[model samples]
Each structure stands twice: as structure tokens, then as C-alpha cells.
Target: MAYKTEHITQQIRAAREAKNMSQRELSARSGLTQSHISQIERGTMEPGLSSLVDVARALDLEIVLAPKKLMPAIGNILGSASVTSDTLTSEQRKLVGRLERWLAGVRDQFSIASEADTLKDSLALLRHLPLSADELDRLREATLHLNRWQDDPPSRKELSEFAHAVRQLRNATVHRDRDGAVPRSAYALEEEDDDA
Candidate 1:
């Protein structure tokens, strides 16, 4: 594979993993088989434009065409990009902060357990998962539950249960395979004849 192809595939792979999405999940969303995704990520097969667009859309990414002269400006903008759609919303970030504070207060009262660590891990994942209104409400409810315990901290077992509940909530928000008509390809791979 050429360096450019390798670089592009690496970006796709990194983006997929950063979103905590498996290639199988991406395959379902992109309407490509898992093997196809694997090959693309490995740079063994050159990706068609339609295939690349599908994969990028599945990852909530947009592909734009720009003049070559603007490459430096575009690169600079991307390099300094912040809080893209893939990241948690501001409200979600605030809730996570509150949860962290609650956790800190709980730790002061009781010896931290593995469940606390689990809760932390779950919170970390919340940052990466796509935020929807319903998910936000669920997260808010979790924060409310934590706040309730702040005044009267729950027992170790109760805390463990709470951690499990949060983990389940996060898992519920994670994307799953869906059945539907996949998006049509935007381009055809076969070369067109100039004299038709």
C-alpha cells in the first residue's frame, strides 16, 4: 500500500477504536462485511470512494472536498479542533464532574472498593458514547441517585449495585447492529468510457 493509503486507513482504525466501536459494529452500520472492514484497516485492499464514505458516515465523520491550495489551512483547523460531535455534550460533561465529586465524597466516608473503580471506568466511557436526549436523562438520573447517597452514603454492596447499574446504562447506549436499507453508494468503482 502507498503511504497515503496506509495513513488514511490508520486514521479510520484509530477513529473507530477511539469511539470504542468494534469492526463488526462498524460493518453493520457501514453495510460492509467485517472482513471488508478488517482488510481496509489492514490496508490490504484499497477502499473504494463509496466504501470509504460509508465507513466515514458510520463513524459520524464527514468527508469534504477542498482545493489543494487550502490544505495547510484545513490541516491547521483540524489540528486545533475541539469538542466534536463524538464527544460528550457540555451538560453531560457537567454531570460527569458532579459524579466525580460525589465519588470523592463517598471515598472520604468509606474505603474505596473495586466497584468504585468500575464506576470511574464507566464514567470515562460516558464521555465517548454518543449523547442523545434520552441517554442524557438516564445519566442525569444516575447523578441524582449518587447525590442522594452523598448525604447518606450507601453501603459497599449498595454502591456495587449502583456501579453495575451505571455500567448497564452505558452499555445500553452503545451502538448495536440494526436492520434497514443501507445507504446507497455515492460512486461507482468501474472506470467510465469517454466515448459512449
Candidate 2:
């Protein structure tokens, strides 16, 4: 089956609301156009992987993809059990803690992984997050922003700007290259400057 864009979009929208964010705030955070966010939330657009990451970052959420079976097993045995947030059983809390740790590891690993591998791993990880329809909408918007980045590589100055925008959405530290910067290729810059 094709990837479920609508489902994911909905989740983004929901998450944003849960965090009490407005569309404009989300747009500013994710570097996405407000209109595009609206379209995705309305189920009129499907976003790519990079956008999803941006949205997830904006919401202080992380994405992970493990085997589908493994997630349900963990959720059922841990999250859905008699384990309220305030009253987590030792085992239940431990499982959630492990998942969080694993997710952190995955994020760290992505810094060194090939871009293609990073994208794939990100998509998989995203599937494991407790996404709702609204959060998915925000994710779609963020994905659109990333698409723009891929289409046109920014200049070093532009990349610095882009990175700053990403930092806003991510609300967390991002890994930089060995030089403490994310590089933008010339071709990528050309692409970004060209008007579609």
C-alpha cells in the first residue's frame, strides 16, 4: 500500500493542538507556509519524509519505526496496561524509558548515516510515535519545508538561516558536521533559488 499521507497529516495537526500551538506558530517553527499546512490538515496534500521530521521537531516529538508487531507488543504490555503516567509500573516505565533511549540513539546515529539511510530510518522511527491526526498535519507541513530544502540547496549563509529555522522547530540541539556546520552543495543552492 502507498504511504498514508492523510493519516500522518491528521496526526500532526492533533499533536500541535495538544501542545496548544496555533497554525502560524507551527508554520514559523517548521518553516512551512501556513497555506500548505492548511492544505495538509485538510487532506489535500501529502508530504515527504523531511517535512515530517520538521513537524515532529516543532512538536517536541520523536519518530521511530520498529517492526509493527514489536510496537503493539510494547504498547499493549506497557502503555495500555494499568500504567497511568502518574502511576507507571516499574516494568511499564522501564519499557517506555528503553524506547526513549533507543530513539535518542537513533537520532545520534542519523548524524553519521548516509542521507538516504537517514531518511529511511527517520520514516520508520516516525511510525512508532504516538501521532494523532493534527500532529500528522503539522508533519506534512514540515515535510514540505524540507522538500524545498532538497529542491534547492542554500548558500552557506542560506543554510545557516535554514538551520536556524530548523532549530526553532526542533526545539533541541541538532548535530552538525565535523566543522560544526551543515554544508549546502552548490547544486542544492541553485535548486533553492530557482522559482518553480
Candidate 3:
């Protein structure tokens, strides 16, 4: 029971952070006291069903019961869907991994480390932003260039230039995706059959 509460709290905290929401904001949205939310998130208080539902709904989530035996299948489906929906492609992931390995090998170099850090930070931002197909293609092209450089350590100047380009890409994405992405609702409303 303690483990379940911890897991639930962790999930709720992670979701709230991912949405860039503060605890007070969530409290306001959920109609719960900030201290109550804090206690719940810390696992110091066990939330009642109604409070849990309120918090979940405020986080754009809902609780659902699934057969224990079907958990693995559900996990697999959701995992694949997440990968498909994300902006990163397999090739881009490979390139990023390759770059990270290279960066790790030369972490002692101050100039290279600074530029590498910038590139890495920009990449993280780029991954989170909702991108159009054309913007995604642009990202693919950038990753392809980065892939070609994977075998060679770029000079500080070159790395800085690449980092700048990635930041520009991230900025453009943010400007274009002003509204952010809307998540799919968990429940669907059914229309009543008037003829019946």
C-alpha cells in the first residue's frame, strides 16, 4: 500500500513538472488547498477518492482500472504510441547518442564542453516543442549534419556555430507552436439516440 501511494505521488509530481505547472497552480486548478496537495505529493497524506479524482482531472489525467493480467499489453501499446507521437526520429536519436558519447570522451576540454552543453540543452528544448512536418524535416537535416560530424571532434568554433543553429531551431519552434499541444481526452461523450 505504501509502495502504491509512492508510485502514484511520483507519477503526479512528474506529470505536473512536465506540464511546467507549479504546485500552487495545480492546487488552484484542482480546488485543493496547497498544503493538502503538498502533503499528498510528499506521500505524508493519503488522498481520498474525491481528492484524487480532482487532482487527476486538474492534471489532465483520469484514473482507470485495468485487469492485472493485461498490464503488460497496455504498457507496450502506450510506449509505442509515445515514440510515434514524439518529434524525434530513430536516426536523430542515434545521432544524439553518438554525440553524447563523443562529448563524454572529451569532457575535460573547457571550450568544447561549453558548446556541447549548449547544443545538448537546445536539443532537449527542441524535443519537447510541438513541431510541424516542415520543422521536423529541418531538424532531421540538422541531425544528419551532426551525424556526419560524429566521427570527428568539431573545433570549438564549429561546435559553437552548430549550437547556435540548434538554438535558432528551438526559438523558431517555440514561436510557431504558440498554443502548445493539446492532449487527447481520456473520456469520450456519447450522443443520445433520439429515435429510440
Candidate 4:
């Protein structure tokens, strides 16, 4: 299948905007030209695979390709069983494999840990499993450390920071998704008055 350049381009533009980043900022982070990003967003140019990877990296996003299940042909003489199982493309397969490995590692750590706090961290890791496994390994490692700290659980400050970082990462991942994107209505940032 061919790359859906226009769709991906629009998603990138929307994610950038949601993050309150400028084209120049993205260009500087991804080492691409501002004009190039503009053109890509405007649908006048299609970025190469490498450029797309760079942009995703700069935005701390992961690109995942899922198999497009084609509809069975109408009035087919053959039975449905004749159709082979739909397979993910090479890129998609690689990502799935990586995620599975990371999940397995987390499971192993969870099994070894015997503390509620450690289990909670493992649960948190599972909650942030995005489609792309780019950060999965890192999260798995962090959870392993938390598990080892069963005797002395992380401080409240540490847990707060971890939660904030996870939220930021989740925001970056789903910023462009229409249906599953994080809703602003779910969270409220309120200011407190010193006088009160």
C-alpha cells in the first residue's frame, strides 16, 4: 500500500498546533526546513519516510501502521476461508513485536514484585501503552525500578512527576486523533488565590 501522505501531513500539522508549537520550532527540532514543513502541511509536498520519522521523533510521537482489512470481494466463487489471514505491513509488524516484548518485560517485573505500590506502578505503565512501542522499553525499565523499591516506595513528589510525564506523553500521542484524542473537558487547571 502507498503512504497516505496528505492524511499524515494534516495529522502532523494538527498535533503541532495542539502542542502550541510553531513550524519553525518543529523545523529546528527535526532538522528540517520551515518551508518544507509548511509545504508538507499544505499538501503541496510529500515527506520521505526518513523525514517523517524525524518529525515524529521531534514531537515525541510514534508512527504505527495497522493492517487495512480489505472487504471480501462480492459474489466471490471461493469461500471466505480461502482468504488468508490479513497481515500487517513490515513496519507495523515490527512495531507490534517490539510492543509485545516490552509488555512481556513489564509482566515479568510485575510477577517478581510483591508490593502494592510496585503493582500500582506496573498498572500505570500498562495504562500508557500507545500504539507505537517507542517509549515502551523506557517505561518498562522505570517500572522495574519502582518494583525494586517495594521496601521503600517512591516519594509522593516522584510519583507526581511520573504522572505528569505520562500525561504529557499521552497528550503528544493522541493530540491529532479525532475519535480517541484526550478531551480537554476531562481536566481542569485551576489557579489558587493567596488571599484565600
What is each predicted model's overall lDDT from 0 to 1? 0.71, 0.50, 0.65, 0.53
Ordered list by lDDT, greatest first? 1, 3, 4, 2
User: How far off is residue 82 in model 4, in Å?
Assistant: 39
Model 4, residue 88: displacement in angstroms?
Answer: 32
Task: Estimate the TM-score for candidate 1.
Answer: 0.47
Candidates 1 and 2 compared: the better one by TM-score is 1
Q: Pick by lDDT: which candidate is best?
A: 1
After superposition, candidate 3 runs with Cα above 4 Å error: 1-3, 81-84, 88-196
In the range 1-196, model 4's lDDT, one tens digit per residue, is 2346877787788779978999999999999999998988887777898999888888877676633221111112012212332421344335334434443444433323333344344344334333335444444545464555456655545555554554454443333222334323222223232221
lDDT tens per residue, model 3, 1-196:
3745677778888889989999999999999999999999888888888888899999998888886544433443344334444555655565456555655665555375666677777666554444556666776676666557668766767667766777776655544312334222222233242221
TM-score of each: 0.47, 0.40, 0.43, 0.39
lDDT string for model 1 (40-159, tens) is 998889998899999999999877887654443344335324336545578888897888777766754434567777778778767655555777898888888865775876877777
lDDT score, candidate 4 = 0.53
lDDT for each residue of candidate 2 in 1-196, tens digit (9 for 90 to 100): 3348776787789888878999899999999888878877787777778888888788887667756424423333323222334432344334334434433434333333353244444333333333334334544454454446556643445434433443332221111122224422222223344321
Candidate 1 residue spans exceeding 4 A from truth: 1-83, 108-112, 175-196
Error (Å) of candidate 1 at residue 29 is: 35
Q: For candidate 2, what is the TM-score?
A: 0.40
